[model samples]
Target: MRLYSVIIPVYNRPDEVDELLESLTRQTYNHFEVLVVEDGSSKRCDGIVEKYTNKLRLTYFYKPNSGQGFSRNFGFEKAKGDFLVVFDSDCIIPDHYFETVEKYLDKHQLDAYGGPDRAHDSFTPTQKAISYSMTSVFTTGGIRGGKKRVGAFHPRSFNMGISKEVYQKTKGYKITRMGEDIEFSIRIIELGFKTGLIEDAYVYHKRRTSLSQFYKQLHFFGRARINISRFYPDEIKLVHMLPVVFTLGFFLMWVLPVVSPVLFFIAFTVFISFFGLIFFDAFAKEKSLQVAALSVGAAFTQLFAYGVGFLTEGWRKLVKG
Candidate 1:
């Protein structure tokens, strides 16, 4: 049996980590070992591991608070499986997730694979809305093409797997604040390896249920983009660039409204159009009023928060430069 090493980098949230372990315990596939690398956190999580210490294959490592990129790299170095799978601490996988991934990999002879991330069904309407907003074309920066074998310009490391040779050849993760996954995937594509999305390999992610948590997440992403720009110059493309542009456009148009009503109209039109698309796409899935409200609020919140974060980071980068 080809062994798969599932490497998860966890920090601070012991409760979610417990849920992750519980999900793993129920997985149908047994040819896997889990390695949980604890990035530096103030809370002690040794007891969490103790619950599953009976598994001889389970290993835990503690390192000073490094970013997720470094924690994942540390896990990759210690992984002994033929394939390395990485998941965020909050992800809850289906029972057949691994079996489906293995089947898809062998069936297509692909180098890497990922799938759709579904928001937890049990989430509140606001949480579901935020989750949908993140997945929406507006907030996700627009991922085109419906083909299962679609390659993202910037794919996430959250639900990704790679061969041992791929890491050995390219070296491991970069110590970036964010977008390390994109950099890593770009390298894989450059190596001429195929990446696929198994539509059936589904996962449920816990969306941030509160505004405070949501802002913190966006803040990290904002800081991450700043650091990644140092390496991948084109990291800020149309999908990501539009929101910032619109934000600035809104501000500029506000000052010049008396000069050109057309410019002011255009700015508001774009803003409405952007949110319209998000709401339309979300409602198409489920025509519930709650979902609609959540979707709209989430989209607005993300755009506003992300725009502020981006400009803040941009200013800091410019000052440093």
Candidate 2:
């Protein structure tokens, strides 16, 4: 059995890290080691690491806060497994996490891969609604879920894996902040490494506990999309611009009523029908009428927050040039 090295870059979320560690301890695949890289987080994880030592081959290291890309690369240098996996601190591993990855790697001759994220059953209502907004096909689900994905498959850092050799050859994660994972995957592919999607191997991503936090998170994500576009123009597909366009369209439709109510009404009705489609789809997956009822807000938040970030960064870049 090939050993897996799980590299988790953590900040100050010790409680979330503790839960992730506990979930890792419960994973059926035992031939794995966990490396907890503390990225200058004031709340340390030494005690948490000690608690899980008996159950897992866990190691802890501290580094000054450079960024997540640097932290992940720092852990990659110390990993001892053939399969190197990275997870965000705010994620829970399913018991079959590694086993599923192993199954996919053993059968498929892929160089790197990523899995999707889902909200846990115990997550808060806001989390559930936000999750629906992200994964719903009508929302970002089309992109983040890896369906009709642009170009080759890119695994997100939340549940991504690459061979140790590939990490060394392609150079481990160098991009930081929001879209680093996708940027890393682009680099991996550019260096001729094949990437695939591990459909069964997913992480329970907590994302943000509230809409306010979620907005803050995605706002940066939107900016990161533009940051990435500057480096890799081909990766910036038309789909990435949809959020910005949607945001502009939404505001324009409202403002246009002053000019002509008919035009505004036409756009409003069209958007409402599209929103209803998203709600029903999210409702089926979430099985919560409350989530279904409120998913529109979540979707709007996801798109608009991201749009603001994207547009902000685009303007910044334009000014710089």
**The best candidate in terms of TM-score:** 2
Best by lDDT: 2
* Model 2, span 1-321: residue lDDT tens: 989999999988889989999999888888999999999999988888889988889899998997998899999999999989999899999999889988878899888888988989999878888888887667663767555665678788888889998988977877667688878888888899888888889889999888888899889999888888878877777878889999899889989889999998899998999888878887888888888877888888889999999999889989996
**Model 2 off-target regions past 4 Å?**
none
Q: How does each model score on lDDT?
A: 0.75, 0.87
**What local lDDT does model 2 show for residue 263?**
93
Displacement of residue 138 (Cα, Å) in model 2 is 1.0
lDDT, candidate 1, at 88:
87
- Per-residue lDDT of candidate 1, residues 239-260 (tens digit): 6665576567767867767888
What is the model-wide C-alpha lDDT for candidate 2? 0.87
What are the runs in model 1 whose C-alpha is more than 4 Å off? 54-57, 144-154, 260-266
